[model samples]
Target chain A: MVMSWIWTGIVLLSILCAAATGKGGQLSSAAMQGAQAGVTLAVSMAGAICLWSGVGKLMAVCGITGALSRRMRPLLVRLFPSAAADVSLAGDLSANICANLLGLGNAATPMGIRAAKRMVRGDIATDELCRLVVLNTASIQLIPTNVAAVRSAFGCTAPFDILPAVWITSALSAGLGVMAAYLLGKVRRG
Target chain B: MTDYIVPILLFLAAAMALRRKENAYDVMLQGASEGLKLLVSILPALILLLTAVYMLRASGAMELLSQGLRPLFALLGIPPETAMLVLVRPLSGSAALAVGADLMAQYGVDSQVGRTAAVMLGSTETTFYTISVYFGAAGIRKTRYAIPAALFADLVGFCMASLTTRLFFPE
Candidate 1:
């Protein structure tokens, strides 16, 4: 698959570059250090993912997700016309977007996967599925917590001063992403 | 206010489930277990990707590439120093954060380059990671146009971030 090729290429390129730059030791250390970081990241993310996923499941069981679907139905229909009739899919998609908008990237993944599962038709990704993925990829963050945290850590007087900039860029990116996906989908079908 | 949103949502969702007689504890436990499973399933690929990313950075390959790309990025209104962050961002979130933090530390946080890096981080997603995980979960094989579209979006985000920072934070 393409992912495999990309991974292989990255490793090979890294090795080649390290040798060329005489940074072989750094590359070795990076291999071990990066793996450690990966595990640390996974562990740190697990608790939040568990909590959100649990809450998401509870919402589904309590019909809260269904209500959300109904409330978001109109917008969801416009965004994903094919999934409009499938309430569960629409609900999952809505929850994913809601989480992303809130800057809960970890919480958004499971719902996004569920929505994609519901929309995917076999091996081929439908236009709706592609659009859903695109939307998630370029999600507009209402609160960019990580950026703010980094700014504050660096002793910035106002970490959120970049709010307006983030808002404009994120919104524009998401909008353009959706439009691009729509257009590309048409071309792919043709 | 932003920090409380997730906790508040969790509390409300739990309370609502409990009120609905949904056996909230059991359902939550099940979902949490499922989450753990998902984490385990994606660990290998995540580790591989992160390792390559870190190796590339530590080996100075990323810097070299960024140096090579500096002219073009400068033409695009992005600071030459931020080329690495922009390139690594869509591939890995933590890596991008590291680069952004470094940029902020090197250049004062209020500097145009620092602000641009922050805005870029805030606006863009880890496209490759997200696509892989979502598609892997959905058991889809052909990504087709998804990657290109997402990368294009990220490009737009990068440009917009640079432009907005210039406008709002005037260097």
Candidate 2:
């Protein structure tokens, strides 16, 4: 797939650049350090994902997700017309969006996967699937907790000072993404 | 203020579950276990992507690429230093945060470049990671237009981040 080529190209290019720059020694160390960093990142993310996923399940068990899905159904239908009739798909999509809106990217993945699985119509991705991916990719983060946390950690006096900018950019990106997907879907169909 | 949203929502969800008389503890355990499984499933891809990203940065390849792309980024109104963060934003979230933090430290946190990087980081999602996890879970081979569309959105985000930073945080 495209990802394979991208991975290979990055690794190859890293080695090539290091050799060209006479930093081969540094490159070797970087490779090891990079792998170690990856493990640490994953382990850190695991805790957040576990807690949120558990919370998500509790929401479902208590019918909170169902009520949320119902409240969101009209908007979901507009966004994903193909998935309108499927209640579970709507529920999953709503839950995914809710998590994403809260800036819970790690927590949102499981629900996103579940929604995507339901929307896949065989080997090819359905229009709904593509839309969902696009939406998730450009999701508007009302909280943007990670970015704010980083800014605060870096000693920014007003970590959330960029909220307006974040709102504008995210809204534009998500709006354009949905538009692009819809147009692409039309092109693909025709 | 934004930092408390997640904890508040978590508390509300827990309170609701308890009031509903649903065995919240058992359901939570099941979901937590499922989450652990999901984490294990996606770890390989995540690690591979992260390692590649880190290696690219550590090898100075990213800097070279950013320098090479500086002119084009400048033409688009983005600070030359942010070219690397913009490119890396869609690939990995933590990596982008590292780059953003580095920028903030190098330039004063209130500097235009710093604010721009912050907005860019806040607005964008980890596009490649999302695709891999969602599509991998669904067992879909063909991504169709999702990648291109997502990248397009990221591009818009980058532009808007720069533009808004200039407008709202004028130098």
Candidate 3:
């Protein structure tokens, strides 16, 4: 898999660089520290994952997600057609997209995973699933809160002054990403 | 604000489920259990990937690589100043923020480099982190063209962030 190569490549590159730069000690400790931090993150994320998963289930049973699908159906259908054409998948996908749009990242992941699981039929990812991932990867961050906060910390007069730039860049990336995925998917099929 | 939104969302969803009297508690338990299973499946991949990313950061290869790529990035209108941030942004969110803040500090917040750095951080979505987590949980091993396509989008984002900031903010 591609991830396997990337993971090995980074680790090997790190080791070689560490040896050359006399950072061997730091690299070893950093790897362990990174693993520990990973556990911590996963533990915290477990709460979020569980919460969202449960809330998502409840939303489905309550028809909240169904209602959302109705509102966003036209857009989602246009985005993802027959490849992942299932009624329930639409509900999951809508929840994921809406959460990403609102910048509710914590809520988005579980919903995204749920939808992705539904899309998974074989080991290889489908065109529809790839498109979904592309959309999420290029999602428009509505708030840009982290950047704004950093700017404000540095004593910027207007933290959100860069809002227009943020909107333009995010929109461009999302649009281009979807287009790229569509083209690449077709080319591969050919 | 986002903190409040999550609680409110959960409350509204739960409240609606309760109104329907659809064994909401049992439904929640079932869903949570599914999440727990997913956590089990994904924890190892998450740990390994994080370790790799951190090791890469500490080794300083990113600095060397980004520096080497600056001229290439320049062709796409991406400022040389944000080269490191562009490299690190997809690998680790915290590291990217640290880099962005450092850039902003180094070049006054209002400077061209600083605004471009901020926009680059804001516009991008931590591609590697998202892909690993999403596909890892879904148990999809062969990603095919997805990775390249996502990285391409990220490249576009970095370039556009520079162009957009320069146009709107004017240094």
Q: State candidate 2's TM-score.
A: 0.94
Question: How does model 2 do on interface RMSD, in angstroms?
Answer: 1.7
Which residue ranges in model 1 land beyond 4 Å of their true spot? none
Off by over 4 Å in 3: A83-85, B1-4, B22-29
Off by over 4 Å in 2: B1-3
Summed backbone clashes in each candidate are 0, 0, 0
Better of 1 and 3 by TM-score: 1
Model 2: per-residue Cα lDDT at residue A69: 91
Order of quality (DockQ): 1, 2, 3
Best by DockQ: 1
Per-candidate Cα lDDT values, in order, are 0.87, 0.85, 0.86
Docking class of 3: medium
- Candidates' interface RMSDs, in order? 1.6, 1.7, 2.0
Candidate 1's residue-wise lDDT over B1-171, tens digit each?
777887888888889888887788999999888888888866776777788888888888888999899899989888888999998998899888988999999998999999999999999999988888888877788888888899989989999999999999886
iRMS value of model 3?
2.0
Which consecutive 10 residues in model 1 chain B have the weakest lDDT in total?
Answer: B40-49
The best candidate in terms of lDDT: 1
Give per-model CA RMSD.
1.6, 1.8, 2.2
Give one digit per residue, the lDDT tens place, for model 3 in B33-88. Answer: 88888788778877887899889988988878997998998898888988889888
